[model samples]
Structure formats: C-alpha cells, structure tokens
Target: MADALTRDGIKYMIARLLENANEAVEESKENKDDAYCAGRKVAYYEMLDILKTELDIRDQDLKEFGLDIDLENKIA
Candidate 1:
C-alpha cells in the first residue's frame, strides 16, 4: 500500500482543490447551468471536509492560517 500523506501534503492538496473549484465557479458564471455548478461546488467542499478530518484538523489548525473559525461554537 502507498504511504499516507503528510499533513502539509494534505494541506497543499486541499488548497489546490479549492483553487480549481473556485476557477470552475468563475467560468461557470458564463454558463446557463448554475445548479449543476453549485452541486459540483458542494461536492468539492465535502471532499475538503473529509481531508480535514483525515488530518484531525480543528479550529487551531485553521487559526494558523488566519482563519479564526470557532468549530466548537459554530462561529468564524
């Protein structure tokens, strides 16, 4: 089996995935199928959540990136 990815590796991949999704959203703005694009974006976000869980990423991890999200409090 392949070795597991490091936390940094996962972070890098997450960023890349988000960037690709954002670009798709921008391009999709010109398309007529908004619902399909929105659905795809939701799927991408769910994948990000999976990666976050795989790394056991929490509020503190996000704080390191300047994202002051209160995961426990449902605030940001």
Candidate 2:
C-alpha cells in the first residue's frame, strides 16, 4: 500500500478525479447506453467527496490548490 497522502497529493488527486469525472460525463453524452461510463462517473464523484471531506476542502480551497478547472475553456 502507498504511504498516507500529503495535502498536495490529495489536492492532485482531487484535480485528476474531477477531470476524469468530466470525461465520463462527456463520454456518457456520446454513449448513453454505456453502463461503464455511469459507473466511472459515480466512482470518481464518490472518491472526490471522500478526499474533499478529509481535507475539509471548499470550492475556494480547490482554487487555492490550483485545482480550479476550466474544462470548457471559459477562463480567458
């Protein structure tokens, strides 16, 4: 098993999980019949919730951790 994660590690995971969840959503849109896509979305979201709770993270904390994603390229 891996060692306990540092705060940065958790934040990094949070960012990656968010990205994966976003991808799952897009994939689900393309293939609504894919059960695996729905499962991935649920798993990623649950993991994110657990990690965020462990770190007591808020939306602002995500931004502070540089995890504020602009998946839609909305940020200029």
lDDT of 2 by residue, 1-76 (tens): 9899787786676667777777877776788788887677667666665654544445446565544444333211
What local lDDT does model 1 show for residue 4? 90
> How does each model score on TM-score?
0.55, 0.62
Stretches > 4 Å off in candidate 2: 1-4, 57-76
Tell me the tens digit of each residue's lDDT in model 1 across 1-76.
Answer: 9989776775577668767666655655666478777666666656655655644555346533322332222210
Report the C-alpha displacement of residue 4, candidate 2, in angstroms.
Answer: 7.1
Which candidate gets the maximum TM-score versus the true structure?
2
Q: Which stretches of candidate 1 lie over 4 Å from their true place?
A: 32-34, 49-60, 63-76
